[model samples]
Target: MKQTNLEMTHNHLKSIVMAIAMIICIQNANAQFANSFGKQKSGKQHPVRVYFMAYDMQYPGIAIGPEYDFLYATHQKIQCNKGTRYTDKHLYFVPQFGIVKTDVQSVAAFVNIELDFKTIYQSGFIVDLFASAGYAQIFENQPADLGASSFENSLFASHGAFFPQFGIGTGYDFRREFNTPIQVNFRVLSASVDMKEFIKPGLNLGITYNL
Candidate 1:
């Protein structure tokens, strides 16, 4: 009976040790997996990007703009619909202001989300798509007496008028120098005035610097 009791204690101790070993193995595996993907930390990472662009505004002619972006979101290791894994995803809040070459002037504050299908570390070929929405001001060459309220001017900035704007675009980033990226994007901007709709399709060429 004593031998049986001794055997029971030994078995219990062995089971405990094995359980501990299994737990350690799992923890090590998780750490290794995270390290392999460069995902040791997950959540808000702050990065700022600044860029300048020249766009051909279809209706008003050409515009030159500068933008400031604040990166506000990131998701690491997201599985795509095609069964591939994306290493990083980011969202940015951007404020842009532009001058439409003597035809018009505009300013906007907006948010845009970017999904990087091919990361810089993975490939030189970049695929980035974005959508933006926000408020904007359009000032155009108008007669001084067209004197209207801010709201009216914003909605009906004729020849030279003012209004809110929304836009969507897709662009690609290519390595330009050591750490700078050159971007070429095509976008469409739209607004309404006195029940009339105006559409402007434009192409943007810019370079971005990260800080």
Candidate 2:
């Protein structure tokens, strides 16, 4: 019975991940299709950005983490009044190391992703949508809860279980030259444990610097 429950949890998580991925793909495809009919230009660019973000989660608590993001052009460039812009596809990899400050103090690590909208060396207003999937490792100081029940133990084990996260936000770019550009954004963050069986949402204020 326990094994059956675990398998069901894994299956459900897989479905949620697949659905989110498909939505992201469809959005990108539509953007590409629209660009295909517009004026074309020659010039390719790749940009890398790093960020320091602070988040408040409804489940475990609050934490701060670092993120890395990069983008590659989609082979076709479209014209903009400023000049020309390319449909740059972005991929983000972020590892969050944080300390939960709730009644249950714990340390956790979460891996996250965010899709950014921008072009090389061009910046003004910006927006990004993000998602994350990972496990949280929790610890308690009191020894009384050591030999808890199987269900409780499994739920809050030293090595925790799966969790899924999603977020969206809008911000602005400094557009500075000969200096590092900065982005400030406000985001609505969310996550779930035991698949979508239990879910929570929160908020995040972040700052990103382009390299």
Candidate 3:
């Protein structure tokens, strides 16, 4: 009876020790996670970055704009079934005013509002996605012989339309090596003047200097 009691006591003590070790390990892990998160948050000295694209081509035309970083976040140690992944993300808002000159000699003035998403990898490669909506006023210059009696026949007749665009892009970040906040991107875009109609495919290549 004494031997059985001693065995029971030893087993209970062993279980208690195992539980204590598990609790200590969990506490250490939590502390390490907190420290890592704190460091990441502290490293973000600038939350908002300003950038500009002097020449942004939209296939049918060219656009120029300034963009602002609205949100920036770092997501590290994301667990997947295979392994862990780390990345940084950014969100930007861009406002642009541009001129569109088509092959048919139609001239347009447009204003656009765009939202951009960027995901940066550790190797300085970036993937981007963006969407934009714009309104344009197109002026059709007709010959004087066409007459100004009707709207369509009038010279310098102006009409308005809306264009929405979405695209995917790839870029390289120079901030890691040059210590300058510059990024160059190339994008393939598809846009529509009227969604119910046809789609216009375009390309955009630009450089952004973040300040």
Candidate 4:
């Protein structure tokens, strides 16, 4: 049977519509498959982790503050039986502000550029090397006979000094199991308080919570 021109045009349009629908379905399926593959490759993607609260015991004194990972990057290397191992070997800028006490009580604010190396494996061990420069407002203790309160002395005798510090630390991350990411690190620090004088060696025990 010979088809009319109108019928032939209608059939061609129908075929075109069906082809478009099939393409749409294939694209949707491909997107779903890609999403599923990503989930299987990496359990949960957390691009940025925050250290909401951090405690640092700086030798003769202690400094308590918060630091977060910013400008972060990571690389996946070493394919294992389970999957690939992801490592963070990048620069992290951490800013901290808190009270510090040494020979004199002070308020410290610092920004650190850190090179951190860690593996996102079951073990979760981390190593960090950082350098920081900041200012501290030191308050010299008043004499007993001054008869001024501690707050009054701190308010009146405060002076600012710039310092540079370098430290190396190692710790373990407890995130895979607990869901609460906590890192406890022991650090060896060298700080130059006098700016031009010799650097003073110190120890630091730090705890940080990563969210």
TM-score, every prediction? 0.40, 0.49, 0.60, 0.57
Candidate 4: tens digits of C-alpha lDDT, residues 61-150 = 444433333335455566789886656554444444444454544443322223343334455777877776655545556553357577
The runs of at least 3 residues in candidate 2 whose Cα sits more than 4 Å from the true structure, single-residue gaps closed, are 1-71, 74-89, 102-123, 141-157, 176-179, 193-197
Residue-pair clash count for candidate 3: 0
- In TM-score terms, candidate 2 sits at 0.49
Quote the positional error of residue 199 for candidate 2 in Å: 2.5
Across 134-211, the per-residue lDDT of candidate 1 in tens digits comes to 222233433333555654443343222333344555555454333444545544444432225454444444444332
Ranking by lDDT: 3, 4, 2, 1
- For model 2, how does the per-residue alpha-carbon lDDT over 24-81 read when each residue is reduced to its tens digit? 6544543553354311222222123333333345444443343333233243477889
Q: What TM-score does prediction 1 earn?
A: 0.40
lDDT of each: 0.37, 0.47, 0.59, 0.51
lDDT of 2: 0.47
Q: What's the lDDT for residue 116 in model 1?
A: 22
Q: Relative to the unseen true structure, what is the C-alpha lDDT of residue 206 in candidate 2, on a scale of 0 to 100?
A: 60
For model 3, residues 68-87, the per-residue Cα lDDT tens digits are 45334555667778677667
Per-residue error (Å), model 3, residue 70: 2.3
Clashing pairs in 2: none
